[model samples]
Target: MDMKTTSLPLSDQLLEAIEERIVTGAYPPGTRLDEVDLAKVFEVSRTPIREALIRLETMRIIEKVPRKGWVVTPISPQSLCEMFEFISELEALCGLFAARRATPFQIQQLLSAHEACRDVDDPDAYYRANEGFHKALYAAAGNSYLLEQLTEMQRRARPYRRLQLRAPERIKASFAEHEAIVAAVLARDEGAAAERLREHVMLQGDRFNRLLQSLEGFGRAGR
Candidate 1:
């Protein structure tokens, strides 16, 4: 029995289970994902399997094909770098605008979102709160177009960002980084805010190495 089959909603449970298989290498890149087979393996209805696969598809971790219903996407280090580079530029602009235009209420909401992360030990829970904080920044920026772009990019980066949180003390470090970003925004330092936001998305030095190590470890952990 899957240990994750409890309390969480049916769709969430299914998504978590399926994504775990992919990350753990049980469903490696190019591995076909059959709905009926998955339904039987998890002892669930096809409805939930379809729902879970659709969500994974949005993450760009899996895709549908002509004959193969779905297969894991081949992710590469270069591709990850390219995605982050684009995301960093988007985030930097949002942070810069937020620092300049955020109202008192929006700033308060941003702080609330960051507070939501404190004491959160679970990687998934932390990731959700972390995502909220980013969304709060976008909302503060008040740019509908940029918000739309970042929203999709954020979705693509979700799984990797969550996995990155699994690194030792990474969650704590992430929180502190968030604090610095918030501080810069509150100070209304546009350049500082942009730089910090860019740095957050584009991990450097030890942080980048940690993400790489985490990815390697994830592959090794797969069945």
Candidate 2:
């Protein structure tokens, strides 16, 4: 049987599952991923596996070798730092533009997104609301091209963001920051919005670095 011919959205499903595994450290940094084994384990065809791996490679989550299949990319502390610096600038700009350009309706929508996060008890739901809040802010900026670029950057940073949510305190702090940003937008305070957004993004990077260091220390102790 050609297992790849299944009616399911196998490629997408496989990609999401693998991505989750990677983010949760099931397949830690630098781990080797075996396509045939994953295919067997997932009870799917090799075709979907190949497609998923290719997508991951494009996302820089993994690297393909001529004869060695795929190798997972490590999330180094330095890389995380650099990514946060870039993200901070993007978000700060988005907030600044949003403050000046957002209509009353758009400001309301952003506020609603922040409120939604308060009712989200699960980490996944909280993350979804958190994303909605940011995307709403970007939309409020009224610059389609800039929003597109920022969205792509967020996609590339998804794994690290997911890691950051492992700490509930961090999630609460993020929501608080979102509230501050929304308040600034409502008041049309561009400087406050931009400064708060920058601090929010930079704080994530700082906390993530500390978290990574602690995880490494725990690993060493275990060894």
Candidate 3:
């Protein structure tokens, strides 16, 4: 993808700022996002901020309050599970079709994308490279509808997915999984590629659940 930094529209900029903050945990879940404060921070009027908050609300990222402004939505374990389950199916289908229809060029692109993530250590870098790998895989599937749904699911899952790369070990494991999937796709093994992708996505959900359980335990211990 191009690295162009095109200027965002006022409302889009506001939305992006809030989304970045939330994804980075700067504004943790359940924190009330004050429209006036955000407007001042972004140096814009409340009109754009209001519009941005409405958009976020539509994404289920924020909840509109009775008297207060929008508050960050709390992601429950159940909701996380459901989201991941849906994504697993979508991505598995993508991988299946990609194996069936991927051209040599597309397979090479997927391999190159996986190679890019081989030794990435920085969390953000690893995350971006991993995302590229998935997107390439989705495109290789050659199903426009599948690609669109996968992209939407990815956007909705971004915040939680960002948390998955907190450890270098997780990043390494993810890259390894990507490599295996690429190998299967290149070999035109549709069933194997789909199985690998399903396992990979499900493993991510498992890791997230384990992290949540650990956090709950730590909270109970007042840590």
Q: How do the predictions measure up, each by TM-score? A: 0.92, 0.82, 0.77
Model 2 CA deviation exceeding 4 Å by range:
1-13, 45-51, 204-206, 214-223
Query: Clashing residue pairs in candidate 3, if any?
Result: none
lDDT of 3 by residue, 100-119 (tens): 99988888888889889988
lDDT per model, in order? Answer: 0.88, 0.79, 0.79
Each candidate: how many clashes?
A: 1, 0, 0
Candidate 1 positional error at 135, Å:
0.9
Worst 10 residues of 1 by lDDT: 1-10
Q: Is candidate 1 or candidate 3 better by TM-score?
A: 1
RMSD of 2: 4.9
The numbered model that scores best in lDDT is 1
Q: Tell me model 2's lDDT, rounded to 2 decimals.
A: 0.79
Q: Which residue runs of candidate 3 sit more than 4 Å off their true CA positions?
A: 1-29, 39-55, 65-67, 203-206, 213-223
Model 3 TM-score, all chains together:
0.77
User: Cα miss at 127, model 1 (Å)?
Assistant: 0.6
* Residue pairs whose backbone atoms clash in candidate 1: 24-222
Worst 10 residues of 2 by lDDT: 1-10
